[model samples]
Target: MSAKALIFYGGWEGHEPEACAAIVEEMLQAEGFDVRSEAGVAVLGEADLARFDLIVPMCTQVSIDQVPLERLCTAIEAGTGLAGFHGGMGDTFRDAPAYQFMAGGQWVAHPGDILDYRVEIAQPQHPLMEGIDDFEYRSEQYFLHVDPGNEVLATTTFDGSHAPWIAGTVMPVVWTRRHGRGRVFYSALGHQASEFTNPQMREILRRGLVWASRTTDSRETGT
Candidate 1:
């Protein structure tokens, strides 16, 4: 059977939530996953979630009712994987403690806007970072308030731009965390559709999705 993947997108139209979901769905489909795309958090029902193998929330500033939010949490904890990029996943549901706990981190700030920055690979051996090297990109330097327990995969160096006084700041750009029995992978990139189309970025996302999916063996085990 093909691996099932559901993409929930919407909120803050300026970010092009629909476009982001399209790209993600296409990529996951190409990776042999049966992908489903939807807009808004309301579509995240228990039935919809139970039928899928993974959940990709592309909704920026998602404000879901307690019912759907709880359903999502329960499904994920039962071993459904979750993955996404930028505000769609991280900056969303800022006031929802359950959402925050499931996401493992929150997007607190993006200092210096979209500027040239250097991303350093922190875990080269990780499946998501494998065959990838440190690269430079002219994008927003995401200053995320990350969970201390997360396994960081990549970081970006902040130069003196937004604040002249704070130079040489290092920030986590990619990470993974375990929430209950679920796996969560988050990347601070993809502020726009163009960013997702980058070959390197696309590869990073594709690998991350696969790595975040439910596996027959435990993640802690080499198997």
Candidate 2:
């Protein structure tokens, strides 16, 4: 059976959660996933969650009640894959450390806000990084407090042009890890749907999503 994916999106409208959800929903559907998209986290539950093979939380900085957040975490621990990008994954629920812990990172700041930056491939041979090259683009250069347990796939060096204190500090831009039996993936990209329009960004994000999915087939269907 095709894998089932649940995308729960809402929170800071500045991140354009709806547009991001549309992009992800289309990608997953094109890849043969049975996709269900929702507007709020409250609709999620442990029982209904069991039907999905993957969960994509596209929420930005918003509060998720403990019960639902706990249920989502429990589902991921039980083997439901989890994946997201930017604030949706990294900067979500600023007060909830557990969510950040499960995501493997938290956005502390975006030095230079929106500007040109290079994404360095840290793991050139990882499946998620396949067919992609270190590239330059303009977006928020997210400075994150990342978990050491993450198997980093890509990184970016802070030139300190905007935040001089962080000059030359390297940060992880993409990573993957395990949450119990579940696979977890995150990218410090996708500030908005437009960010994914870049071929490299789109390719990397799509590959990461496929890699983090619970399905056994990891082939890229060119979504």
State which candidate has the highest TM-score.
2
lDDT of each candidate versus the true structure? 0.81, 0.86
Please give the range of 10 consecutive residues that has the lowest summed lDDT in model 2.
214-223
User: What is candidate 2's local distance difference test score?
Assistant: 0.86
For candidate 1, write residues 156-196 as lDDT tens digits.
87776787665787778888888887888998888888887
User: Could you tell me the C-alpha RMSD of candidate 1 in Å?
Assistant: 2.1
lDDT of 2 by residue, 1-223 (tens): 8899999899999899999999999999998899999887776753478678989988888887788888888888998889889999887788998888899989989966899999999978777887688999799999999899999989999998888899999999999888887889898888888888899888888877887787757634211
Off by over 4 Å in 1: 164-166, 215-223
Please give the distance, in angstroms, between residue 61's alpha carbon in candidate 2 and its true position after superposition.
Answer: 1.0
The 10-residue segment with the lowest total lDDT in model 1: 214-223
TM-score of 2: 0.95
Model 1 per-residue lDDT at 162: 88
- For lDDT, the strongest prediction is 2
Stretches > 4 Å off in candidate 2: 219-223
